[model samples]
Target: MSSSTQVSGTGVVAPPDSTGISIIVVGGGFGGLSCAIECKRKGHSVVVLERVPGLHIQGDVISFGPNAGRIIQRWGLHDKIWELCRHVDKLVLHNYLGEIVREQPLPLPLWGAWGYDGHRAEMHQVIYEYAVSLGIDVRFGYTVQEYYEDDAGSKAGVRVEAKGEVVSMEADLVVAADGVKSKARKYILGYDDKPRSSGYAVYRAWFNGQEQGVDTDPLTDYLTKGEDAFFGWIGRDVHFLASSAKGGKEISWVITRKNDFEVTDNWSFPGKMEDVLAVVDGWEPRCAATLAKAPSCIDWKLIIHDPLPTWISKSARVVLIGDAAHPFLPTSMQGGSQAIEDGVVLAVALQLAGKDNLPLAVQAWEKIRYLRVRESQLIGEDVRNRWHRCQPGDRGPMLDVPRPEWLFAFDAEVNAYEVFESVARDIRENGYNRPVLPPELAP
Candidate 1:
């Protein structure tokens, strides 16, 4: 396959040869799918390989801020996403006694739009549908066994084990969007850094409010009766968050507390309702009542790793995206959102650099994205600490602070195109280097 022709400045380049630069995306989760869609939209031939046979619906809900919403709108998926999402109006913080401590209204104008809350599975399905519509190939039940870059370093690809047979596929570029436990990360970096436990585990449950026999108490009413709202309770070393989804047809809650015993980092572990109720024991009547009615619960251990030294390989033909590149805490609410941003920026960088300069493009992608992701991860850590250590007397700004507009107003696609040349040129002149603080993240 021939490299795509380069177009200088802000113009979109025409697709290269009939077989545009081939890109193999490993993993079919939100990040992988989003990257595939963006790359395909840029006229690249793309394929997604997944280890699982079908959609992994382990996570219950996800929050998409305006940064992610902009990309969704660009992909013409806003209507579809809106259908599955509930617009969050306010976030209400309560004490252990269930008394309202602070109510913070979501900054709609600053956010560029209302924040969206929806099931992770539904969002995944929507992106999958869009990818299929674009004729992008998505293969399931194919596990990547190894990654390799051609001897000349002009191309890269992966070896996969599919249907009990080993298949070797080569592409001009390889995007590893595999989740937190990324195999490609190990292959590219030549070592593995085990994820460290955050000393916290979350018990989550989702069900219909009415069917669960949850009485319409003030707490429940505040959460489900009006415009979308998020209710949270902060205790010594634990926190509870509840919100409605799909127009209050469904409600989900997660109880995150210090973990004292050994627990795997998996997302689905059968949790005893009695254990969950006991955790929130003397807290609030409504909180206990809500937990008592939950049909089932899953315990997910929270684990985190240090910022990766780099997200690109020496060959640069193979690169990591999404969780494979940067992982985040659940509190960040930016896990999926950051992944979406990564995909868009990567695609735009590729488009601007053209196929012949793929390595430079990948470098540009990393330069523009690294600090932003790191900042968000740190923010997540900060939020987690504040929520866990918050005392009963703490109120208002102590519990919640207004987030910076830059976090929500960013358009990754536009930003990437605007800065691609300078970033790529810098990489070519001097090897890729980290910024003390990227301008985007500067206070």
Candidate 2:
């Protein structure tokens, strides 16, 4: 990402005891940025190669649970980041006809909890701008065509397409934060790790309220007020979630329904308005009206894959971090959070392992994270199952979104420090262990 503006940054200074390790992070999304930022914080020389030429400030709402929130705070941006987020006081749940089921308050105060629910592009800027302030070497428009590592040479790297020619860049560690269609996956796994259809797809839209004429209708004008609101509608085989943020200036909604399209490299396409309306027929009037206010929408297919055997390659010099390693369902609401956790933990693992024992560090990091990530991924599936199977009149616990302390209460950096030594020792002696096996998260 290229920028001419000066940034004061979070005043996060790199440590003096540099790891003396060279790292290359592929991708410029949230996950990739997090890894590069954390690695730099730990005094490692890092370069981020993003295929995009400039920061594309696209995307609607994004969330950062407390688990990821704590890491942002450490970078001294807790307030600056969360301030731009919508102030969602509660999440109201209802049946298809707007029958109120439950009105759940924000699990914790927005600022106190440190978790943020805000615009995706804005949240990204919060992290990216900080990375720039720290004077990080982020090379935009650099696309990785392939990933490689040499155990013999004790290095890892990626070949990028530059000036219509391939350029090779090597580093001690190469992190694939490349998203779902990650080129690194096949290279790391020695096979095409294809994604399966989740049998569900989300039709989503985001637009400004007053600008879209939403406030003109009494049926939907409530959304134009200067207060953020969240509402969910559950049904037999579908669920709809909508929220208004930025003091009701803008609105966004997502409706999940069964999908039968063939899987391809393309995961999103323009959604048909009729199809979107059909999903909510005979449902809440306000819900339909709000959806009607949407100027445009996209059909986003939720893709899944059976958990991989490993995120690290044979050489251990290359590793997958975010969506490249694990993709979470929307219901899980922890995809981005988990990706951030991976970056933080991996950086900590590298520090503890020292520069020479790089293999041990990456292995220990995977072992430490694998099971917890699997368990977290399943949470989204379970929530979707429960909501999709809901009988219209269900009540009480059945209409709950579980934000268990186990998931949100985690402090990744501290946890990494606590577990690294023993996990590294265990991996060195006995190899990696898999204690939990969540069923394949595919329909």
Candidate 3:
């Protein structure tokens, strides 16, 4: 194993902190960027290494439940989020024939309770721009190759291939915010089990309001002019979801199905326009016509993993966050949200632990975060099963009347700090109790 005491590869000897700790965030996606921003706010020097040059704005509109909405607000981007997003008032469920079978109102309590909804493009800009303003040293085209933790597990760092040069950067803290297939995770924990395909393919695309005309039919429209809505078709073995973005100027949609058929791994790989049109074969005329107007479609193979028992490494020096820690299917629509939660909770844990006891702080963070993320992962799985059914069946908890209060009511910012303090108390009282590490995290 490589040591964290020095920054190798780069001739410049990057000095360690004298006043505060240093952190390196691998991956510049939503999760990684959020972690980098929060770490800087708390008086830490941070660097974010992103393989992509700048942000790659894709996906039409990404939905965020109340839990994630609240985090965006606390991050001071609520106004911008609302400005950039169209507010969704309800979610409508349809059958394969495009008949509106069920319509569930957006949980009202979620509004004042947790507070807002998320629009993907707007949320991305808010986070990205804010990180830039905070003086976060984000270097694009820097790909991380591996992570090296100290033998004593006292500190962790990573090596990156930036601008055709391999540079080893050391920090008091290292975050593996890399996506589902994370190199940092593989090096730190020593496992390279790639994300397994869940036997489903998804077709996604966004349409500008001008070219893809909006529907005025009351019966066919899922959302009114001002209100955005999530409309979907659920069957025994397949499902499709659609919604508007940027206040209805654009529509984003996805189709998911089981692996009886083959699909590609790329999330943005193009699909035959006719194939998508064919999938909604029997959809209501109005819905069918609207879908037919889609300009293009991107197809991707869906992947998932069995719930890991825990997320903490035994040494407790380096742990996974975001997709690295818990990769979920789109059925939950909470991947970005959960990743945001991971970054915040981890930051709060370290904050509470203070700088003196880094080891104990890491342990406490893992203990508090494991159960919540695990429960969420199971909920996502249940959702996937219910959504991808090929034949009609009674709606499960996902479509249950009066949706579960636990999900929409979650407030990550408040709950995050609250959970961190609670876990710290437990560790203080019981001593260093070693919980079982998740199968994914286990060596």
Candidate 4:
């Protein structure tokens, strides 16, 4: 057993003996890349495989709560991330007619840390650069086709197709972070369980403030006042969320409404400006004016599957993380935050378990995460339902304002360390036991 601390991108040294297990993380998105970084910090040799040929910068803006911000700070990307993101100061809710429903202040020391609103592309670039700087092997343009485990079930790996060539790579553990439509998911469940439609679809658009004629006005002035803000308009079966990003240089909004059509699970679709306006036709002039200036938009169908029975494979050498393990509604505002948590906890568990107990580490990761993820998914569902069902007179608990402290103040790395011994002991003595929420985070 060697003991040496590896230097990370932040110039901070990780714990002693941080290297041993070889891990292959599939998908290279938020979850995969973050996991690779954490694993590398733990002294594990990690390889990240992304199917795309280049950087994936398709989506618009995303929010990261304090839960993720703390991890970013730990990883030494706090300053860089703050530079790329806008700190949200407040959230205002309005009815269809643009009447104020409520206002919530996101003061400093919010949930133990400030929140961020930024472009997804910028966030991805920051993480990608950090991963490369740390020497984590990242291979792009490789699509995974199959997953396999050794006959003895001690090792798991994947077979991928890169360009015209098929390649097989083996690792001590395989982590599938391949998004909601994961190919590795079927292998874990022994069958395909496609994501089900949430009966809702979102039309999203992002554009430069100047090009989009996004001048400050009484209706939209709240967004351009230096501090970041989220302005929402709620209507029967429809809602719109608008905010600024890239330091107010860009404006982005999403219109979510009940959909009856059976749409594909793709993240985006070219949408006409007329159609985008139609969704919010009777709501407010500011909403129309803001969206009409956008040159283009993408229509995304929201879909979700049931809670997976388990994230670990039968061999226990392979496991799922992030969306591959649990998918959440955009309403949750936790999609990226939860994925970040997954990576940290998984790495901590693997580090504590050491190489010989890889199976136990994987099981422990799933046991610790499943219930918490389910709780978030359910909260997302509840919030989505309330937002869509809200009418002129009724609006439920406004968007988890001041977000539950339990959700934001959690430190995955610390929690994993605190629970690893007990979790491993339970797994050793009684197989896998369903884990309960740490009393601090429990509702």
Q: Each model's TM-score, in the order given? A: 0.91, 0.93, 0.84, 0.92
Comparison by lDDT, 1 against 2, better one: 2
Which scores higher on TM-score, 2 or 3? Answer: 2
Over 1-443, each residue of candidate 4 has an lDDT whose tens digit, in order, gives 23353333222346433557899999898899999989988778889999999996778877778888888877778788787776666677888898887676676556566566678899889999999998888999999999999999988989999989999999999999999888888999899887777888889887777666565555555566655557888888888888876556678888888876664657567888888888888877888877776778888888888777778888888888898888878888888888988998888888888899888998888888877787766767677777777766764355444477778887777788889889889999998754455544343
Candidate 1 deviant stretches above 4 angstroms: 1-19, 107-110, 215-222, 261-267, 434-443
lDDT value for model 4 = 0.80
C-alpha lDDT (0 to 100) for residue 207 of candidate 3: 73
- Model 3 scores what on Cα lDDT? 0.67
List lDDT for all candidates, in order.
Answer: 0.80, 0.84, 0.67, 0.80
Worst 10 residues of 2 by lDDT: 1-10
Candidate 1 local Cα displacement, residue 89, angstroms: 0.8
> What CA RMSD would you report for each candidate?
3.8, 4.8, 7.2, 3.6
Off by over 4 Å in 4: 1-18, 216-222, 225-227, 263-267, 394-402, 433-443
Q: Candidate 3 on 66-179: residue-level lDDT in tens?
A: 677766666667777666665556677877776666777764436454334444656777888998987889988999887787787677777789788898888777888888
Model 3: residues with Cα > 4 Å off, grouped in runs: 1-19, 107-121, 214-229, 260-268, 390-403, 425-443
Root mean square deviation (Cα) for candidate 3: 7.2
* Model 1, position 394: C-alpha lDDT score: 85
The digit string of per-residue lDDT tens for model 2 on 1-443 reads 22333111222344633778789999989999999898887777889999988898677777878888888888888888867777777788888888888887775543345788787888898899999987778888899998887759499978999667899999999999998898999988899988999999999888888898877898787666668778888886999998888788888888899988788989899988887888888987987888888888989999998888889888889999888999989888888999999998888888778899988889899988988898888899899999999985687666677778888888888889888999888888897653345566332
Point out the higher-scoring one by TM-score: 2 or 4: 2
